[model samples]
Target: MECQVKANPQVKEVVWIHDGRPIHSFMATGNVEDSEKGVDSDLNQYQSVLNQRYRYDHHYQQQQGPNHHGSTIIMTNQSLVIQKVHRSHRGRYQCVALNDQVVPGCKANQKHQYGVSKNEQIRIRCEVDAEPTDDLTFRWTLNTSGTETAIEWPSFTIVNKTISIATYRPESSLDYGTLACSAQNKIGIQERPCVYSVVPAGRPDGVRGCAITNHSMNTLLIECLPGDDGGLRQHFNLEVYYGPNESRSSMKVLSEASAQSKSFSSSSSSSIVFDNQGVSAIQHHQQLRLHSNHSSSQPNFLVSSLTPGTTYTLNVYAANAKGRSQTVSLSAMTLASPEKHVARARDSETKLTFFFASEQEASNKSLYIRFLPY
Candidate 1:
């Protein structure tokens, strides 16, 4: 690694910085008369003071011995040589010349936008970078519709001389806007503050492209495409409804009391049956409810213990802290069990019989065999 320096004022010293820390430095070795000959006398005075404040370790010099092979200074002090360089040597490298002062700068390690609920508090953090962090201070501001206001104390805290945390809450619509944080030191305040936009949380978009992937006499496999989360964490829900295959008008109507009484146990919660006025008064079933934290490669649901040869209306909904999304509906039917069959054969002196049983009969009954002369 090499960093060449060419300055009119004759750089008083050069420091090699790696990952925000000084690793090595090269100081000019000459008489006072040679160092005083510079275009800017004021800058020369500043460099003298800076050299006193900023000190470099002699670790690099010690590594140049014959027993050491870590890092060493080569032909010129401007170049650095590292033996057996590996992953540990990977980082930001900077060549800093002591001539002027720099102002503080800050950046936030968060997304540009945040979804906030009404009266819900949120915390934001900022990282400040500057020389001489001893007298550093921080300030926060809120900007809404071209109007900016300073955030008072008790809402922000500074830690470790480099990080700042601010707590904020949006009470009304006007509080939704941009929040910014800045740092200041003995040199000067930051030119630009770290900014983040705040927006209101909303209902998630409805699931899409739902279809019955596979079905059997008592099970069905359904898959759907997920939608946007509406700037917040969201969950999924599947509702199953069973009704007759006839027209809507001819379908049977169930009383509210009867619908509520027909509740079944499930993994998440007890399922319930309800009736809609225009449509058939079908029996509703909560097949599955996945929480927001539930993660899967694909949004799929396997519904079991369903009735065979039955038509069902499936509705999928997405929900978040704000509200639930519109329903994405799909109509599917469970396969009907095949009928049983019997086969018989007779020879001159013997008889053979075969019986194929239906699913229910196979589960409930046992096979029987008999041998008799024809």
Candidate 2:
């Protein structure tokens, strides 16, 4: 490969070296006729190499103009091209112009934006290019809020010559900010910066202790304990199904039912049961209610306008910054009104027998004996 290096009159001699060993050298004495004689450098050490334009100038008219009287001269294209480049040649190389005049060059890939999470490990690589590459050293820094902080050894590990890896734990005060890698030599230092952002969280854990509490003919109360909030604030949603059963078809009907009669009670602990018999039965009414705004401290919900004597399957789900959790379901049936049972008992002949029904006697055998005036 051909490598062209610029040259100035002050550059009396130019030497091509790889890995601190000389490959070729060109000595300039300011004369074009002596250019071929000045190439006294060795090339047979590794491979065949050549040099061009290394001589001293005696007269100005012979080179540029008849009247140009300058002691020093400037040479344009000074190149060193290799034939059939080999993998072994891929290493630090330098084109030394005048022994003590050091020149530095910087190289690095373009910085890109990366998405990361808390406590994640990341690797960054940067490169430094300079004449006499061994003269340079590299280090990294972090920029936070316009403040620059140098990276230390144990906190970040160096990989090979140009790469480094570090683990970022946001909990630590030192881990947050943009990253920059700097290359420094005797001449100067150059740097490259990278950008990154944190990714969103995942779904939270499920809620616990989800169960139905006290209820009247038209309202029901439910309570639950929220689990892990996925590192963010959480809210709740309650879905009620009151169709034939837990089948998908019944759930579809429940999904279509309007919640115009549904509402949340201001009381922390309350019940929900429907006063309208048509809406209370499984065959006639299906309703789905949602309650979004509630305090995490008090997870008790008072659902209103529910049907009496009808069973409902209620599901409570919690949501946070990430997503919603799996639903917790509970079933409860509202109690039938006592006034109808009292009316039926008055219509019966034996007052003692009329006081109790077969279904009621089977469920609750303990009778409260109360005497009424004759």
Scored by TM-score, the top model is 1
Candidate 2 TM-score over all chains jointly? 0.30
The digit string of per-residue lDDT tens for model 2 on 64-172 reads 2233222222233344443233344445555545433333333545433333345655554444445444555655555554345544423555454444454444444
Instruction: Report, for every candidate in turn, its global Cα lDDT versus the true structure.
Output: 0.60, 0.48
Candidate No. with top lDDT: 1
Please estimate how well model 1 matches the true structure, expressed as its whole-model Cα lDDT: 0.60
User: TM-score for every candidate vs. truth?
Assistant: 0.42, 0.30
- Model 1: per-residue Cα lDDT at residue 138: 86
* Model 1 residue pairs with clashes: none
**Every candidate's CA RMSD:** 15.5, 23.8
